[model samples]
Each structure stands twice: as structure tokens, then as C-alpha cells.
Target: MKKIKTKEAVGHVLCHDITQIIKGVKKGVAFKKGHIVTEEDIPVLLSIGKENLYIWEKREGMLHENEAAKILYNICKNDYMCPSEIKEGKIELIAEKDGVLKVDIERLCKVNSLGEMMIATRHNNFPVKKGDKLAGTRIIPLVIEQEKMDKAVEVAGDKPLIKIMPFKHKKVGIVTTGSEVFYGRIKDTFGPVIREKLAEYDTEVLGQKILNDNPNEITQAIKDFINEGAELIICTGGMSVDPDDTTPSAIKNTGAKIVSYGAPVLPGAMFLLSYYKNTIPILGLPGCVMYAKRTIFDLVLPRVMADDKITLEDLASLGHGGLCLSCDVCSFPNCGFGK
Candidate 1:
């Protein structure tokens, strides 16, 4: 860093903040550190009594903080994400649409492991809304070695390390199973809840079928929905191990590959996930989803809606933060549950 007249500092990065004081009005930083002195900022600097300023000295093979931030942003950004303007040596990624956030955890770790830089992000494989903050990138110093950022690029490989898979429109079918609802012994509450949840996304309820616990009838209903062009099938109720619970068997009978019959999540341990024709998803939701404010269904719904395939390993990874606290005020997705 070197001191120079503020008039000659245009285009140079400030090495320290310029403070301004106003009697009974305001007292704050007039110009922040790392701010590039622009012609328009001259009056502001002069008003702040900054006759001379310390600025980062430009050097070959070294990049300014904002430049390094751009490099990090390039390594992390993908479709459906927008980058915040570089500010104070930092940049943030924001979602441009509702979708599921996918993070390349392996590459992310490698980049952060390289000292003096960081890429902090939200948990991977979670839902994000439009304008939601996805990740932030910056280097620790006001200037960084260009070669170090090159290494980060190499570690990230050809593809970006972060992405937002936009939710796709889907035709969904609901199969409500249980003899109680089928025989009018009880009202069909599951269908309403499922419909309400589905309304959150771009989904068309192709149709819904209320069937008894008979595996054959349940199996036939599922097949019929698929035949009618349903892209996703949801079976609510009858997911338990009880002798009368037959939804799991019914789904399997449709020749769909079962990904997992149970998850480690509380209130959702009996959750079942399957793929039909390796494209359409078939879900057997546990009874907990009917009443629980947040469950595994909340975690998995975004992925399914985005057409992001869920693997058994994904389900296994939920055990660490799978228990919902059932807080008096529910702030799901923002909380640690299913993270």
C-alpha cells in the first residue's frame, strides 16, 4: 500500500475506510475499504477531509479482492442463479427462481481447503426461493495471488460447483389408501393435505383415488394414474409395517424400483421413495405427514418437484439433522431440521 493525493487516487482501491462525521445527522464510513476511487467519489472523499489516501498497490500476478471474488463466483455459479455485485471484496449468489439448490460438496471442500479464500453456502439439496441467498464468495485479503485463484478454478473442474435446478411442472396423482376412509368410517383428510402441499408448486392434480387397504386395488389405482400420464404418484397412508398397511406392496407391484422404504428422520421413519420407469417418482408418505408441520416429505418434495433424483444415500445422510424440534413457531427450511 502507498499514500497518494485523493485527486490522483481515482481507479485505485482504498486500503482503508474513509470516515465522515456530520453534526447531529450522520457519522459513518464515507468510503469503505476496497472501494475503487471513482471520479464521482472525489467530492465525497474531499468532503470527508480525505486529502490523501492509502491504496492497494497494483502488482503483476496478484488480483484485487473484487477480481478474486469474480473468479470465485465463476467457479460456483450455474443456471438459475444470479450474482450480487462485488462489494467490499465479497460476492453473493442469489436464486433467480424457485428450485432445489445443488452443491458439489467435494469440490466446495477442496476450494475452501485452499487457505485464504472461502465459499460459504446453505446446506445442499434443499429448497430455495427466488431472491434467496444461495452462497457467498470472497478471499481473506484485500489482494490475492492470481495463481491461487487459478488453482481454485482447476479444483472446480469444467462445471460450476453450485446450481439451482428449477422446478418443473408435473402431473401428479394421489392414491389415498385405508379401509376407514374408503368405507366412510372417517373423513379423507390426507387428500386435502396432499393437495394443499402440491399447490405450492407447478403441479396439475390429474386425479385422486380413494381405495381400501386391498393391495390389488391400490396397485391398480397407481398403474391407472401412470397410464393417464401422471408424472408423479403419491400414496398417502398404509405405509407402516402393520399387517393391513399395503401401500408399499402396492407400489412395488407396479414394477417401480424402490429407492428406500424407510428414512432415518423422526416423524418420517416410515417414508418410502421409489422411481417408476426410472423417471417418474412414486412416494409412499407416512401418516406423520398428515399432521406434522415439517417432515421428510418437506425435505424430499423440493427435489422431486425439481426432477432431481433422490438416492438411498441421500436418505441415509438425513439422520444427522433429521429430528424436527416441533417448535411453537415453525420456520422450516430455515431451521436445522433435515439439513
Candidate 2:
């Protein structure tokens, strides 16, 4: 690119956008890239303090910032993600649907580590809504070497750096176990909480049964729900080691594979997780879930809704970020819980 005095550059093309700022009244591009510099435009350029402006000049092995930004966008954009118009050599990625955001951390780090360009994104595996800004990319200078962008793309490889997995519509069944609630001795707050939680993922509780702490009865209820086409089953209460707790036993009797009977997360340590017929997830939630606003359920539910299996190792990893601050006013999902 060639640089010339703003007053003498009447016919040259602008290589970069000259921004005009006026405190709260206005802040915008005074002369956009590729705009021909007419004699009348010289005064406008001087108003923005542009003593010298760059004119278009191509170099082999180099790319303009706008082109570099598009290359970065191409590497990160994927299904359910949309890119905004490139402005000021920057492009922002927005979510096309309400769903969970996934970022490939390793690749993202490698790309950012490459000098002269960057791509910043929202946290991975977090819930996001439509129109939410997921990521932004830009080149540091007016131009960057093409080799740098190629290296960034190579680090990103064929995998998408950002994606939104839409939540699935599944029929869920809830089996509330405990003698007090089964006999109406106490209000079943647990049932309602489980229902409300599932509803967040667009899952409907198709069938729910109130059963006392009887292994056989709990087993029968679970089998009934499966026969009724319940894709996910939840057995709340009776997961502890108390003599009357039989939810775990009942789930085992259903011949489902038990992933883990206990988790490392606080407020949900006694959580029981199992899978029926290798497809349906049956969770035996402890009493803590009824009162805690955020728990292991919040951490694991999104993965389930996205059809991602929660392996034992996955549950074990929750220990690092398991404890919730339990603020009086819960700001779950936005808080550190399950991060």
C-alpha cells in the first residue's frame, strides 16, 4: 500500500476505513475502504485527523485485514451459526438458534496463539439464545501475511471451532419415590422441580408416578414408562443409603446400565445415574436437588438433551467446578456452577 498526503490524494482508493467520532452524536466511517478520494472529500478526511492515508497496493503473500477476517470466520462458522457483515475489518458470529454453544478449546487456543489475528468466543458448552453474539474475529493491523491466516486455519483443521447443538424434544418420565409424598402426607415439591427443569430443554414429562420406597414398585413404574415411550426417566428421592431408600435398587432391577450412583458435585453428591436398554437415561436425584437452584443436574442435563452420553469420566471431571456459591439470588448458568 502507498501512503500520500490526504490533500493530494484525490483519485486514489482508500485502503482502510477512516472512522469519524463525535462524542455521543455520531461515530462512524467517514470514508469507507475503496472509496475514491475526491477533492471535496479531502476536507472530510482532514477533520478526522488523517494527515496521510493508505491507498490500495497488493503484495504477494499478504492479505488485507478484511480478507483475513473472513478467513478466520470461515474456520469457525458451522451449522446453526451465522456471521454478521464485516465492518472495520471485523466479523462477529451469532447464534442462529437457541441451543448449547460448543467451542473446541484446544484448537481455539492454538489459533489465538498465532500472532497478528485473533478469534474470541463465548464459553463452550453453555446455553445460548438466538441472536446471541457467539464470537468475533479480526486482524490486528490493516494487513497481515497470508501465511499467518493459513497457519490459523491449519490449527483449526476440519473441526468447527464453534457450533450450537439444538436441544432435542424428548418425552421424559418422572417417578417420585418416598412414602410421605406417595401417601400425600407431604406436598411433592420434588416432582414439580424436576418437571420445571426438564421443561427448560423443551422436554415434556409425559408420565409421572408417585411410588413409596418399594424396589418392586419403583421397578414396575420405570418399566411402565419405558413401555409408554418415555425416552428419559427420572427417579427422584430415595437415593441415599437409608434403609427405606430403594430408588437405586429399583433402577438396577430394570437391567439398565448404571453409569454412577454418586457424583462429585456438591448439592448433588448422592445423585444416581443409569441408562435403560442403553438408550434412556434414568436419574435418581437426591433431596438436595429439590431445593438447590443449581446442581449436577444442571451440569449434566444439557449433555443429555444434546444426545451426548455422560461417561463416568465426564461425571468425575465435574468435581473441579462442582461447588456452587449458592448466592441468595441464583444466577445459574451465568454463575460458576458447573463451569
The whole-model lDDT of each prediction reads 0.93, 0.87
Poorest lDDT segment (10 consecutive residues) of candidate 1: 42-51
**What tens-digit string does per-residue lDDT give for candidate 1 at 83-103?**
998889999999999999999
Query: In TM-score terms, which candidate is top?
Result: 1
Off by over 4 Å in 2: 5-43, 46-52
What candidate 1 gets wrong by more than 4 Å, as runs, is: none
Ten-residue region with minimum lDDT total, candidate 2: 28-37
Error of 1 at 185 (Å): 0.9
Summarize candidate 2's per-residue lDDT along 1-339 as a digit string, tens digits: 798898889877688778999998999978887566799998888888999999977679988777899999999999988889888789999988888888888899999998888999987777888899999999898778888898998889998898888888899989999999989999999988888888777787887899899899999999999999999998898989998898998999999999999999998999988888788998888889899888888888887787767789878978887898899999887777776
Q: TM-score for candidate 2, please give it.
A: 0.87
The predictions' CA RMSDs to the true structure, in order, are 1.2, 3.4
